[model samples]
Target: MQNISNSFFELLNKIQEKKKGDDIQQYFAEVADYLFKHVAIQAGETRFTFAEIEFYYYKEGEFEGPLYNCTYPRTRNVGKFFWHYSGMDICFESSEEKKYFGGILIRSIKRGSEIIAGPMRCSDEIMNSCDGELPYLVYCETACETPVSTIRYGIEADKNQNMKFCFYIEPETWNRKREGVLVADKATGRYKNVSKTDYYIAEPKKR
Candidate 1:
């Protein structure tokens, strides 16, 4: 059986290999447009209520799934709050294995038929068991339920508006923690763990 790190690496490789230029951007744009037209306009509000859009992809093609609303009993309260106040969550799954890859949380709007959104990393339940190296079990005696650490990936724009695929490690903690991004090794062409400062320094600033 493949470990979580290896599985995640393979997923990233698949995305890097299969994705054409602007494909991801175009996907997000379409999602944003759909939300703006269907949800925001119907609600008569600039901010959207809690909602989710899931997509599935195989080696051949991509398919968009159904949209979810906060009325569902299982919808997370945090997700509802974020969608109402911030953005909506978009999840990705593999059609071949029916496995979840991850998701991006984006705040979007329509400006004269043009959709604009900023992608941010969002946490997701990738697997059933927490036996992987990526996420660790967090034991808490006083808490009602223990939470696990998770890793999230998304596209983020830097100070110069240069966008890059980034990963964030969210440890189980009450306080805020520093986030890190993945760096690609020139030799292997695979991503390796790097400090946030190193990532910022290594990436060239765009004009």
Candidate 2:
């Protein structure tokens, strides 16, 4: 997990950690070219939502990092799901462009206004209490095939009917991470409790 105050500090720390000389221009050029290579490919949106809530099943206050992500299943219908990751932002490089890389899915979660099978909706009351005043999330979902991971797509259960999506976050702010880690805690807060649903397929992820 890379930790730094702001983007500038982050960059400084990253370069120092690599022992790379002060070749900022070269670094920029490399990044630009990489982006250009995947410029014309396909892409999708990666959203992160954050929030605090109380759950009915829990004893102690444990931490949780809201999972934010986007998916693009390749087929006749390119269905989609835009989520609210109140603070997390995502970018990806396709592991397998067209063949095996089904679609992009990034995971970051936040307390939501309500999970009603749709794009991150912000007009509901639940949104009001989220870390960010806005209840919903909106992101630009594009089709960029390179410089992004195909694994950007969200994950499904292993068929055992007993699994939960896990996340490891290195956030920028204490407030952001704090609100995020409290959701499923029966002791502190609970975000969305999919544990009760028998077959809780995530909102369709494709675009």
Local lDDT at 124 for model 2:
32
lDDT for each residue of candidate 1 in 1-207, tens digit (9 for 90 to 100): 111233332333344344433365344444333332333221211222212222222333332222211111222211122232223333343222443233434322222222222222212221121233332211111211121111112212222333322222112221222356677899999998865421221111111
TM-score for candidate 2, please give it.
0.20
Top lDDT prediction, candidate number? 1
Error of 1 at 178 (Å): 31
**lDDT tens digits, residue span 89-165, model 2:** 12221122232111112232233222222223222323334563332223222232222111112333212322222
Candidate 1 lDDT at 75 equals 24
Q: What TM-score fits each model?
A: 0.24, 0.20
- Give each model's whole-structure lDDT: 0.28, 0.24
